[model samples]
Structures are given as C-alpha cells and as structure tokens.
Target: MIALAGAIGTGLFLGSGKAIQRAGPVGTLIGYSTIGGLVICVMLCLAELSALAPVSGAYVRHAEYFVDPALSFAIGWIAVYGPCVSVPSEWVAVSTIVRYWTDLHPGIIIAICIVVSFLTNIFFIRVFGEVELISAMLKIALIIGLILFGLVYDLGGVPGQSRLGFWYWVEPGAFGEGYLVGGGIGRFCGFFSVLVNAVYSFAGVETTSIAAAETKNPRRNIPRAAKHIFVRVFVFYILSLFVVGLIVPSNDPHLLTSTGNAAQSPFVIAAEKAGVRVLPSIINAVVVTSAWSSGNHGILQGSRSLYALALEDKAPAFFRRTSRWGIPYLCVIFQSSFMFLAYMSLNSDANTVFGWLSNLTASSTLAVWVVVGTCSLRVRWAMEAQGIPYQELPYSAPLQPYLAHVVTWFSSFIMLSGGFYVFVDGHWNVSDFFSSYFTIPLSLALYLGWKLLKGTSIVPLEEVPVGTFIAIARANPEPPLRKKKGVVGWFGRFWWD
Candidate 1:
C-alpha cells in the first residue's frame, strides 16, 4: 500500500502538467508507458532479491553482500540524499497546492505540513503503516474519481460543453514542436522530455523492497506487493493521463501556468471548462494529502536508510541509536531538518524551485535504480558461478539478468540525457544543468573515492556467498503459506493479507 501510494503523489497530481505541456497527449502516453514498462522490470528484479534477503536497506544491503562494500557505501548515501531533496520538494508542492484555495502564506502551509509529518514519524511511528494505508486509499479514490470525471467531460456528458473526444489531439495533431527546434527533431525532443518528467512520477516504486526488513512474511509479501503494485500503479497512471489528454488540450496555456494549485492541473482545467465549479477545490484538497503522505514516506525511507548505514558502520554511530519503539529518532531529526529548504519556495517561484528539486531527485532516483540493477545482476552471476540452482532462491524473477541489463543501461541513458536541452545554443541555464546531471558525477566520485581510500574491490562471482545465504534461508525457513477461509479470506485477498 505504501509503494502504491508513494508512486501516485505530487508528480501525477501537480507536475504532470509540465509533461503534457512539453509533449502532446500521445507523446505523454508513450513516455509514461515506456517508463512504466521499465519500472516493472526493475521491480521484478528487486522482488527476487528482496524476497531472498529481506534485509534492511533492501538493495543497498544486497550490494554489500552480492557486489562490493564500496558500491553499497555509494548507493546508500545516494538513497539518503534522494529523500533530503525529495521531502522538501514535496513540502514545496504542498505549499503551492494549498494556493488553490487562498493566499495562505506558503511558509505557514509548509511549516504545518512539516510539523505534522515529523510528528507522525517520531511519535506515531508504529502507526505509520496505518497512516500511509489511509492516505493511499484516499489517493486511489481521488485518481479514480478524476479519471471518471475526465471521461464524462471528454464525451460531453456534462450539460454545457460539447463532446471533446480526441478533438485536442486532432487539432494540436498529437505532438508538440519540442524544445529548441521544429518538425521531426522537435517532436523527438518533446517525447524525450516527457521521459524525464515521467521518471519523477515513477521514482518510488521500489518502496516494497525498501520496507522488506520490517514486513512480516517478507519472502511471500515482498514479491506479492511487487506483483500487485505494478499492475495497480500502471493502470492508474496510464488511465488518468489518457483521460486527461482526451479532455484537455496539450496546448492549453494553463498547462504551463504555475498557479501552485489544482488550477494548474490538466484535470482541474478540464473540469472548469466543463462548468464543474467545485472540482478544483476538491482536487486540491486530495492532492495536498497526497503531498503530505509522500513527504512522510520520504522521512521513513531516508531515516531507515541512514540507520541501515550506521548498522553497517558506514555512518556515525549515533545514527544507529533508537528509542523504545525502535524509531531512529536522531536520524529522523536529521532528515527532517531538510524541511527548512521548503522555505525556498517563499523567496522564489515555488514552481521553479520545485522543478529544480524534482529534476535533482529524479536523477538521483535513476542512479539508485542503476545500482539496484547492478546488484541484481551480481546476484544472478553468483548463482551461476557457484552452481546453485534457481530453485534454491526464495523467489525467482522471470527474464533473468536480461531485464537487469536493459533497465540499468536505460536508466543510465535517461539520467545522462536529462539535461540535453541545456546544451542547445540558446537554452543553457547553469542551475538547470546542475540539477539534472550532477548526481551522475557525484555518484561516480563517491564510488571511486571510497574504492581508492578503502582499497575495496568488487566481490568475485564465485565468492559472492550465495550458498551461505541459501543455507541461512533454509535453516530459518518461513512458515508455510496457508489458505484463508470465507468472506474475510476473500476480503484479505482483495486488498492484502
């Protein structure tokens, strides 16, 4: 539920307008579908690893055991840095989203959100799952409602508006003349730009793996969550975007306008055009919850990652300290301090700051996925070199290391190309370039610096300890899966056990 909920937040509710504005509806669909497919493959690979190890830090730990300790050190910090920026980015989103209703000072809104999310992380940490579960359910409901509303508006089901059915696509002709060019070149740029935007939306799909250490029956549940999440998130994202395209024109000026609220959303614009006066406020309200929920999730991921590092002696020992509830109180406090960065939205255009932060976090996310793919590939190679049958694994993902190879290279490609527009003759911007591409070099430098300092080497394929982990799994076997009975059983399966 956390993974499902995390994937549907600010990027879809707010930032998607940027995508629709850059690429036309068809281009947006193509880009999201492409990224969505890649995310599914990544999740599949992660599922195999997490189900087997179910360790703290997920792939970060997998790297230490299956790949190299230096690799783990690099990826672990990347994980930490991702949420530091991403959490504030969500806070900025909340501040802007609150603007749909009033001129409530963004700082006030940001402060309240930070306080509430921080408290949730520190005090009610045990109930974090319940809080996220409720938030996820609400987000699910909102997306479904918005999709249905979009379909009705597009088909002229509303009283005043004429049927819009694919009118925008036909008139705008399906593709935008993209950044810095025209015709075919511009169209390609436009589509590629959508890929960059879509990366942020799909950034957190691997949370199932991240939370594996805390989950019950992880060998069964981690893989189960991965399988379920891919389908739900894919359907919701594609359908919502497809419906938005049908009702709202890609060329709509409002798509580019930053109102810091639902007014900037394509669905909200479509609703207003259809004479649905109340929908903007409703959408804004739900979206604010989504932003807060995602921010809270960032705290969970970031703090746990820091705690994992301390557990491995890669970070300061104080970060390993926990409260009676096992909450990483110090780590949470440290990660929560980044919330002050949200105040940047007060001094500058909230939208611009958000764009910068999202780009940085998006690139960081790509780097994380690249590392994850590498770790998974190492796992498979170890199995082969050590002569362990696939059946010895807790769970085996289909497509072998091929999917791992494709996703790793593709993620690297997208990460590097994220700032391509900055290279155009008239489009260069220093901040934009750094935000889009800095993570690449930073990650490389971290890996190289640690390797040189510690003299660490990548573990050889034959010595990766696959047989040791398999023996551990066999010795402490999970309880056998059992069938549930009656209506409650049906309900459990309908959602989750």
Candidate 2:
C-alpha cells in the first residue's frame, strides 16, 4: 500500500496538469498508458531478478552479480541520490498544499514536513509501514472515488449536473488551438512533447520492485504485487485523464493560465465543474499526504540501494551496517540528509526550480530503468551459462530476452532524445536544459571512470564468482509448499509424515 500511495502522488495530481496543457487529454492519456506498459515490462524483469535474490538492495545487487561492477556502482549511487532529491521536492510540494488551507509561511510547513519525514525514517520498519499504508490507502480511495464521481457527473446522474461526454476532445480537435503542426514531422514533435510528461507520470511504478526485499513471502507476494501494480496504475492514470478531459476543456481559462499556481490540479478543476463543493481543500490534503508518502518510500528505496552497494564493495563500508531490525542506519541518514538539501531550492521561484529539477529527475530515472533492463538481460545469459534451472525459478518474466532488449534500447533512445525537448520546445532555459539532460552522459562518464580506477572490466559470464552468482540465484528460501512437493513422489503409497 505504501508503494502504491507513493507511486500515485504529485506526479499525476499536480505535475500532469501541465502535461494536459501540452498534449491535450487524448495524447497525454495514450502516452501515459504506453509508459505504464514499459514500466510493467521493467517490473516483470525486476520481479524475476528480485525473487531469485530477495535482498534489500534488489536492483543494485542484481547489477553487481550480472552486469559490470561499475554499472552496479553507478546505479547504486544514483538510487541513493534519487530519493534524497525527492524528499525535498515532497516537502516543497507539501508546503504548497498547506498554503491552500492557510496563509502560514511555506518555510514553516517545509521545516515541519522535513522533521516529520526524518523522524519517520528514524523509527522501526513497522511504524514506517503503518504510516505509508494509511497514506497509500487514502490516495487510492480518493482516486477511485474521484473517478466514479466523474463518471456519474458525466452521465448527468448527479443532481443538477448536465451530460458532458467527449466535448473537450472534439472541440479541441485532440490538440487544442495554437498547437502548431508545421509539417508531418512537426506534428510528431508536438505529440512527443506530451509523451514525455506521460512517461514521467508512470515513473515510480517500479517502487514495488524496490520493496521486494522486505516483503513477506516475496516469492509469492512480489509477483502478485507487481501484476496488480501495473494494472492499477494504468487504469487509474488513463481513466482519470479521460474523465478530466470529458468535464474540463483543455482550453479552460484556469488551467491554461494558472501554470505556476498550487491549485492547478486538473482533478480539482474537474471536481469543481461537476459541482463538487470544497473539492480543492480535499484534493490539497490528499496531495500533501501523497507527497509525504512519496518521500517516505523514496528514502526507503534509496537506503536499501545504498546497502546493496556497500555489500558489493561499491559504496562506503558504513552503508553496509544493519541494525538489529535489519535497517541500514548510516545509508538512511546519508539519503535523508541529501533530501533535506534538496529543500534549499524552495527559496527560489517555485516554478523555475520545480520544472528544472523534475525534468532532470525524470531523465535520470529513465536512464536507470534502461540499465536495470540491460542488467536483467545479462543475468539471464549468466543463468543459462551456469546451467541454472530457469524453469524452476519462482517468478518468470514473459517474453524473455526480447522484451528486455526492447525496453533497454527503447529507454536509452528516449533518454538520449529527452534533451531535444528542451531545445525544440523553446520553453526551457539554458540552465534547465543542461541540468536536466546532462545527467545521462555525466552518469556514463562516472561509471567508466570508476571502472578504470578500480580496474574492473565487465565480468564475463564464465568469470563471475560462483558465490556471487549463487547468491542472486538462490536468495529466496524454498517455500513449504515446494518442499512438500519435492518429497511427494509415491507419497500416497508411503504415507510418511
């Protein structure tokens, strides 16, 4: 539930309003669904890998044993930074949410959220899980309720509400006025602009895979969770957008002009149009909870990745230290501190920093997913070479090798092309472009440099250490049911207990 809550946050509620503006409802919805599919593929890959390894540092450990050590190092470090960056962003977002209810200072809200998030991290796992579960449940309930309400409103089933079916799409012609289409290629560019934002909305669906290590009965639980996650996210995201488009025209004055306002959620706007009273405040509260949830999960994932890096000797030794509760204290502290630092941007103009930071993070995330897919492919090959019984694996990803290669290459292409959006759109400042786009190439350089310094080439399948290989392949304990099956031959005749 924590993973679901964190997955559905500010990215869809607040950030996607701008995406609707750029891509129109139809284009954006389609793009989001496509990205959701990509995420599902990645999740399947991770699920199989994690079920085999079932460690706290799910992807980080997978990379180390299957791919180049330097790839693991780069992925681990970036994973640590990813959540830290998100923490401050969530605080800032929560501050914005608070401002809707009161004129209290943003700084006060930011400080309070930071302290609360910090405290949450310091507590034991169950406490953290409880908070996350509640937050996730609330967000899920709100989204589901909102979707149902919108459908009723559209059907004129609600009191005093008129039918509002498909008007927004037709009048806007699916692209809105002033949407330039210089040539065939230019139209594709406009569509691509919307696609990027849709992709970003589906970014954190993989958070479930990050939770694989800590989940009880992960062999069964993780795979079930992953399947449900993909279906839920896709339905929720695409359906919400479709409903929003039905009620609120893309050219609605509020959304078109209120680019930087805190109350710019399309959900809120749609609710208002549907005669839902006090909707803004309700959505605002949900948004705050969502942001906080996002931050909590972010820190949890980051710390685990750091712990994995330490285990692989790719990060500082302190990160490897686990408390009695199996929490990596030092790594958590390191990640939380970075998140606190991200809050420094709140001092600047909110819109500018938010756009820049979001773009950077989105690009970086895509790059990381690509690497994960690549590593999964390598793990597959390594498993085959070692004569591992692939069919006996607890979780199997469908369309092996091909899907992995397609997703890895596709994500890499998108990561490389992301920079051009800033340039061609002419909306991004030079600083924003550099900060957002350069992270991809910069990460590559860092990985290569580390490999050179450490004298660690990408280990061939034959050369990978037997213990390390076994560690990943044999991480999950055999289930009782499986154990029972193993001794069941002629069991009816023997009747042995």
Candidate 3:
C-alpha cells in the first residue's frame, strides 16, 4: 500500500490533465500503459535481487557486492536525492490542491502541508507504517469505487444517462482531428510530449523493493507484494485512464494547454464533463487526499534512503541519528526543510524550479533503475562463478540473466533518449536543458570525486566485509519468539522454580 500511494500521485491525477491535451486520449493511454509495462519489467528484476539480499539498502547493497563499489555509491547518492527533489514537487502539488478550496496563499498552504508530513514521519516506524497502510487503503477504495461507478454509469444503469462507449471516441476521433490543426511532425510532437509526462506517473514503483527491508518476512512476503503491486498499479492506472478518456473527449474546451494553469486535473475535468452533479467536487476532494498521502509517504521513503546511505558511511554521519522510536529524525527534518522551500515557489516563479527539479529527479530515477537491472545480472554471474547452487535458491527470476539484460537496455534507451523529445520540441531553454541533463554529469562527478578523495578502489566481492554488511542488514531485527512455558501442574517443583 505504501508503494501504491507513493507512486500514484498528483502526477497522474493533475499532471495528466495537460498530457491529455497534448496527446489526446488514445496516445496518452497507450503511452502510459507502455511505460507501465517497462516499469514492471524493472520491478521484476529488482524483485529477484531483493529476494537474494532482503536488506535495508536493497539495490544499493546489491550494487556494492555484485557490481562495482562506484556503481553502488552513485546509485545510493541518487536515491538520497530522489526524495529531496520529489518531496518539494509533491508539496507544490498539495498547495495546488488547497487552491481548489479557497483563495488562500499557496505559500502558507505549502508550509502547513510540509509541517504535517514532517510530523507524521517523526513518530515510531510502526506508527508511521500503520498510518500509511490506512491512507493507501483509502486511495485504493476510492479508485475501485470510481471505476465501478463509471462502469455502471456507462451501462445505462444510471437514470437519464445513455451509454457513451464510442460516443466521445467517435466525436473526437482517436487523435484530436482539428484540435491542433496543420498536419506535420509538429502535430505529432504534441502527442510525443506525453512520454516524459508518463515517466512521472510511474515514478516510485521501486518503493516495493525499498520496503522489502522492513517487511516481517521478506523471502515469503516480498515476492507476493511485488506481484500484487504490479497487478494493482497496472489495473488502477489503465482502467482509470480508460474511463476518464471515455467520459471526457480529448478535445474538451477546458482541457489545459501548455500555457494554461497547472492547477487543473484531468479527473476533475472528466467528472465535470460526465455531468454527474457534485461528482467533480467530490473528485477534487479525493485528489487532495491523494496528494497529501503521496507527499507523506514520499517523505517517509526518502528519509529511509538517506538512513541507509548513512549506515553504509556513504552519506553524512548525522543522517544516521535516530530517535528512541527508531525513526530517522535527522533525515526527516532535513527532507522536510527542503519541502518547505517549495512554498516559496508558491509566491514566486517557482514553476520553473519545480519543472527543473522534477525533470532531473525523474531522469535520476531512471538511471537508478538501469543500474539495478545491471546489478542483478552481475549478481547472477557472481553466484554462478562461485559455484553457488542455483537450484536451491529460495526464489529465482524467470528467464534468469536474459530478462534482466533486456530490461537494462530498455531502461537505458528511455533514459538516454528521454531528453530528445524536449530538445526536438525547442523547449530546450537554458534552464530546461540544464535541469534535464545535469543529473547525468552530476552523478558521475559526485561518484568520481568521492572515489578520488577517499583513494578507494572498487571493492571486489571477496574483499568486501560480508560480516559488516550482514550486521547492517540485521540492525532492525525482528522480535524473537518466546520459549514455551511449562505447565504449573505439579506445583513449584514441576515449574522448575
């Protein structure tokens, strides 16, 4: 549930509003489901690695042991930056949600949201987990209810509302016929604009692997959870998108353009179009809940990534500090502090800042996924070379090294060419160019700089301290079982008093 809440956020709810305008319904749906399949492939690769390691650091630890230490360091630093960049973006999203309710200042709203999210993370780990579980449940219930309601409405099950299966699709055709008139690549460019937009919607599916560390029984639970995540995310995203497209024509006049406001949400627009009185307002409220829940969970997961880095001495030692309740208090405070700055954008031209931050972070995440798949392949090879018995492995990835390799290349192609759409569209202004491309160089620079300063070579598996790594993995050990108590049947002597 934490994984679901973290991944499906304002990116899908609100950001898709603009995407629909650009790509039309058919293109946007195809683009989202395509990217979703790729994300699932990446998740499958991570699942195998998680089953092998099942540790707090997850992929980072696997990278260190199976691949080069430099790869581990690079990916770990990127993981730390993930939430640092994402929390602010989500804060801006929540502020936008509040704007729907009143004319209150966005800055003030962003501040309040950040404070609430930070406070939630400051409690015990179990308490935070329980809260996230409940929030996730709410989101799941809302999406399921919406889907069922839309299905029933489409079947003419609701009074005075006729079925609209091909109505909108026929009216608008597949692509917007006259929407962005003048045929050429320019028209097609608008459709391809959704590629980057889709990436954001699929962002945090990796959280399942991240949470594997804290799961009570990872070997048994992690794979089950991963499969569940794949099915639920795919269903919710594809079905919700299909329903929205069916109800709201792609060329709806109110659909926001690139120059339009960021506060618009596709779900809101679709509900309003369906003419189901008050449904639009209800969806707006649901979206607000979704944004708050997303931001809260992002903050939680991001801090833990920092804690993992600190434990490995790859990050500043201060991030390792925890409260009595086992919460990474320092990291949470640091993460929330960054989120507060998102409010400043509320008053300024922070949209540019948000755009840059989001692009860079999304690119970094794709890079991390590529590394994860590559590291999995390396782990399999190392196991084979060491004469490890694969047959006895607790869980094995289907198709072994081949699927991992293919997915690695697939992710690499996406990351490598992801910037081209923006570039070709001439949206490559100085800020956008730097924001989109900077993470690649910055990650490499940080990794190499740290290596040069520390004078450390990439540690081989044999040279790496297995005991130290295992000790870190076992830091937050599960509770031990109580010994069976003997009956007091024969008085004190029988009780071993």
Candidate 4:
C-alpha cells in the first residue's frame, strides 16, 4: 500500500503537464515506456539484493556492503533529503489543489496538512500504515475513475459536445515541438525530459524493501510486492498519461496555469472543455488526499533513512532516540522540519515551489537508481567470488549482472542529462539549472566529504562479505506459506509469495 500510494502522487497529477508540455502525447508515452522498463530492471535488481539481505535502510545498506561506506553515506543522506523535500512538495501540492475551491493562503493549507501528517506519524507506525493503506485505496480508485472520466470526456459523452476522439492528438499533433530547436530536436528533447520527470513519480516503489526488516517472510513478500508494484504502477502511469493526453492537448495554456489547482490538471482541463462544470472540484479533492498520502510517505522514508544512518553512527545520535512506542520520534521530528520549506510557497505560488522541489529531487532519485544498480552488480560479483550458486539464493532476479549494468548506465545517462534544458538556447535560467542538476554535485560533495573524514574505501569483490549474509539467510529462510493445493495455491503464490 505504501509503495502504491507513494508513487502515485503529484508527479502523475500535476508535474505530468510539464512532461506533456515538454514532450508531445506520443513522445510522452514513449519516454514513460522507456523509463518504465528501466524501473522494472531496477526493481528486479533490488529484489535480489533485498531478498538476500532485507534490512531497514535496504539499498543504502546494500551500497555500504557492496560499494563504499562513503558512497553509501552520500546516497543515504540524499535519500533522507529527497523525502524531506518531497513532504513539503506534497504539502505545496495540497495547497495547490485546495486553492481550487477556496481563496485561503497556500501556507495555511500547507500547515494544516503537514501538521496532520506529522501528528499521525509521530505516535503510531501501525496507525500511520493504516492511513496510508486507505490513502492507497483511494488513490487507486480515483485514478481509475479519472481515467474512465477522461475517456467519456474525450469521446464527447457530455451533453452539447461534439465527438472529440483523438482530435487533440491531430490538432496539436503528437509532439509539443519543444523550444530547443522548436522542431524535431525540441520534440526529442521534450521526450528525453519526460524520461527524467517520470523517475520522481516512480520514487517510492521500493517501499516494500524498506519495510523488509519488519516483514516476517521477506524473501517471499518482497518479490511479490516488487513484481506487483511494477505491473500496477506501469499500467496506472501509462493509462493515466494516455488518457490525459488524449483528452487535453499538450499545448493547452491551462496546462501551465499558475492557479496551483487541479484546474491545471489535463484531466480537469479536458472535462471543462467538454463542458463538465463540477469534476475539477471532485478531482482536486481526491488529489488532495494523494498529496496527503505523498507527504506521509515522505516522512516515513526520511525518518527511517535518518534513523538508519544514526544507527550506523553516520548521523547525529539524537536521531536514533525513540519514543515509548518505539517510534523514532526525534528522527520523525527532524524529517518533518523540511516540510516547512513549503512555506517558500507563501512568497511564491505553490506551483513554483513544487517545480523547484521536483527538479531538486528528480535527479537524486535517478542517482539512487544508479547506485542501487551498481550495488546489485557488486552483490552478484561477490556471490560468484564466494562460489554461491545463484540457485541457492532464496529468490533470484532474472537477468543477472548484465541487466544491472544496463540499468546503471541508462540511469546514469538520464541523471547526467537531467538539466539538458538549461543548455537549450533562449531557455536559460540559473535556478532551474541549479535545481535540476544540483543533486549530482551535492552527492559528490557528500561522498568526498565523508571520504575525507572517514577514509573508507570500496569493498573489493573477493573481500566482500557475501558469506555472512548468505549464512544468515540460510539459517533464517523465508517462512513457508501453506494452503490448499488447488485454487488457493495460485493466490498463495502471489499473497504468500
């Protein structure tokens, strides 16, 4: 549920317009498909690692074991920062949607949303998880409803409207003809940009692994969660993007509106064009829940990452302190601090703050993918060096070291090209450039600074301690799930892994 809800946030609801504006309809689909494939590959790699050695920090711990402590340090804090900013971005998103019905300041909405999410997370993990599950269910229902609504709106089901069909696709054509060269190159650039933008939306699909330490039978559960997440998120993103593009043209001025409401959503835009008067309010209301879910997810991820770092003595010990309920209250409080960054939207509009925060985290998310892929490769090499046959593992990812390398190189390319728009003539902006590519240098600085301070080196493959983790896994195998052999067996495979 966390994975489902975390990845279905403002990126799909709001930032998607920027993707459509930069790329055209067909191009946006292509970009999403390509990145979707990469996400699947990353998920596969992560499945193998997390199943082998499930832990609280998951990939960050994998990086420490397979790569360098310094590298892991860089990745860990960035992971923490990513969610920190994301919580506030979701707060900004809530305010963005709230502005649709009320004239209240975005800061007020931001405060209310963050306060609720903070209170929920500080006391009870189970309660927080339950709320997230409900949020996920709502998000799933709303997406399907929105997609169906878009289809009806697109086919001109509304009264007094002509059958639109794929009229927008032909009217504006497929490509948005970006500003790079204002032609095919711009279209291609636009498509390339979507590749990176989509990364942020897919950020939290690793939640299953994040929760691995608490999972009773992680080897079984993690694979099921990862595979299901891949299929579900892929379908939702592709179908939603297609429906949104089919209904509203990429060039719709409303797509770029500063109102910071769901009115800027292409789904809302399409319905309004079809003469539907009240759907934007409904969509915005549901979207506000998504924003809330998104913020809650951010707090969970950020606090856990910081707590993990503190456990490893990388972060201040204050973060390691917990409450009577075993909740990492101090870490939660620290992570919640970043939510105040949404206050920046008080001076600017919520939309501006959102774009800024999205750009800042987008590259870091991709960088994490790169690091994860690299760690998976190293883990595989360590296994081979230790003479552990792949079949002996609790779960094995299809396509071994090769897929890891492919995902690593591909994600690295996207990370490098994240700020490509800054290079486009007549589209220069310093803040845009800084926010888009800043994570790269920030990561490097963190890595180098940690290295200078601690002088940690990458673990060599032959020296990698694969044997110890493997022994632990062997001693404590994934608990076997039993059920009736016929119809129930099939569901057992999915639900019980």
Model 3: lowest-lDDT 10 consecutive positions: 488-497
Best by lDDT: 1
| 342-434: candidate 3 lDDT, tens digit per residue | 755645554455566667667877878888888777766655655555554445767778778877887777666766655554445776677
Q: Candidate 2 at 51: error in angstroms?
A: 2.9
| Candidate 1 Cα outliers beyond 4 Å, as residue runs | 258-261, 477-497
lDDT at position 229, candidate 4: 87
**Per-prediction count of colliding residue pairs?**
1, 0, 0, 0
lDDT of 3: 0.71
Sorting all predicted structures by TM-score, with the top scorer first, yields 1, 4, 2, 3
Q: What tens-digit string does per-residue lDDT give for candidate 4 at 1-497?
A: 77888888888887888788778788888888898999889888888888888877888888888889999899999989888777888888788778778888776887898788888888657787788888889889988998898888777786787777888778787887574677787778888888877887887776668768888788877877888888889999999999888877888898756767667877677667876677777778778888888888889888888888999999998888988888899998888888899999888766777888887777778878889899988888888888878887777888788889988999888888888888877788887888888898889999999999998998988888777877888898656755567778887665534
Worst 10 residues of 1 by lDDT: 255-264
Candidate 2 vs 4: which has more TM-score: 4
Cα displacement (angstroms), candidate 3, residue 349, comes to 6.2
Which 10-residue span in candidate 2 carries the lowest summed lDDT?
488-497
Each candidate: RMSD to true structure? 2.6, 5.8, 8.2, 2.3
Q: Candidate 2 at 146: error in angstroms?
A: 0.5
Return the candidate ranking by lDDT, descending.
1, 4, 2, 3
Question: lDDT value for candidate 2?
Answer: 0.72
- In candidate 3, stretches whose alpha carbon ends up further than 4 angstroms from where it belongs are 123-126, 153-162, 177-191, 211-213, 257-263, 347-354, 384-392, 456-497
Cα-based lDDT at residue 307, candidate 2: 79
Write down the TM-score of every candidate: 0.94, 0.87, 0.85, 0.94
